[model samples]
Target: MMASRILMQRVCCVLVRDLRGSSSYSSSLTASATVQPFLSRTVLRSSCRSVSFNVQDHDDFTERVINSQLPVLIDFHAQWCGPCKILGPRLEKAIAKQKGRIAMAKVDIDEHTDLAIEYGVSAVPTVIAMRGGDVIDQFVGIKDEDQLDSFVEQLIGQ
Candidate 1:
């Protein structure tokens, strides 16, 4: 019984550390001791339904984007691309604003050369909006948040 209680306290400390990031250890300890179960449920629900995820391969791409029930926004990017780093998160924020009306698929261009070539991606941060397995719209380069939001809205017919 003592060992189990210690383990539970340790788990709570980790949870508070992860959730708050740089939280005071004393406060985290207090919160964890008082509100561990509630915090755990909230964290689980949010993390499980993340809007964006990386495409593992061509088959994964086909399964997720080409056959998705919701319209998909594919971000063709590379790790070394500066613009891609800037745009990827912005695009994700825009997609999240839609509240499950759309989904975002991240594709690493360097890893998926064939997909980049097939899609005619000549630059990093190439965004492709697709529906019904067809390319509905595409643009190459980083777009500002408003432009990204408008692009997404247009695809979902908003």
Candidate 2:
């Protein structure tokens, strides 16, 4: 993939250079016209996997979850929790179905105990939906795919 992308970039550069001499348009405009589609395609490919992410710290949480324009589902879980293991993937799948409509922040309770406490998480696999820094909804324990889907749908609706 990297090789192909590099090759494509080289080809585009050559095309832009050739067009620079053949056309009356400015070289910058010619280069931009040649590169815009490639840039957009790369962005589209990356956006598919940008819906979910792991929380790093309080500051990271604030930046990603609290400040997000899109509604966010904060998954507070622990590595040692059995139910968390079950719900994590199901939550991700549900979020994936929503595409870029919403985002999920996976917070490991053990790593970020302060966040769990602040969010009132008393159990593993606690899913909290937030929009504009305010909590909209939440649930504890594992949920089936249908339930998760409905939960995400409800979040998006709000």
Query: By lDDT, who's the top model here?
Result: 2
Query: Candidate 2's C-alpha lDDT?
Result: 0.84
Question: Which residue pairs in candidate 1 have backbone atoms (N, alpha carbon, C) closer than 3 angstroms, thus clashing?
Answer: none
- TM-score versus the correct structure, for each prediction: 0.72, 0.72
Candidate RMSDs in Å, in order, are: 9.7, 8.1
Per-residue accuracy of model 1 over 65-145 as CA lDDT, tens digit each: 899988999999999999999998899899999988899999998999999999999888899999989999999998899
For residues 120-141, could you state the per-residue lDDT of candidate 2 as single tens digits?
9999889999999999999999
Off by over 4 Å in 2: 1-45
- lDDT of all predictions, in order shown? 0.82, 0.84
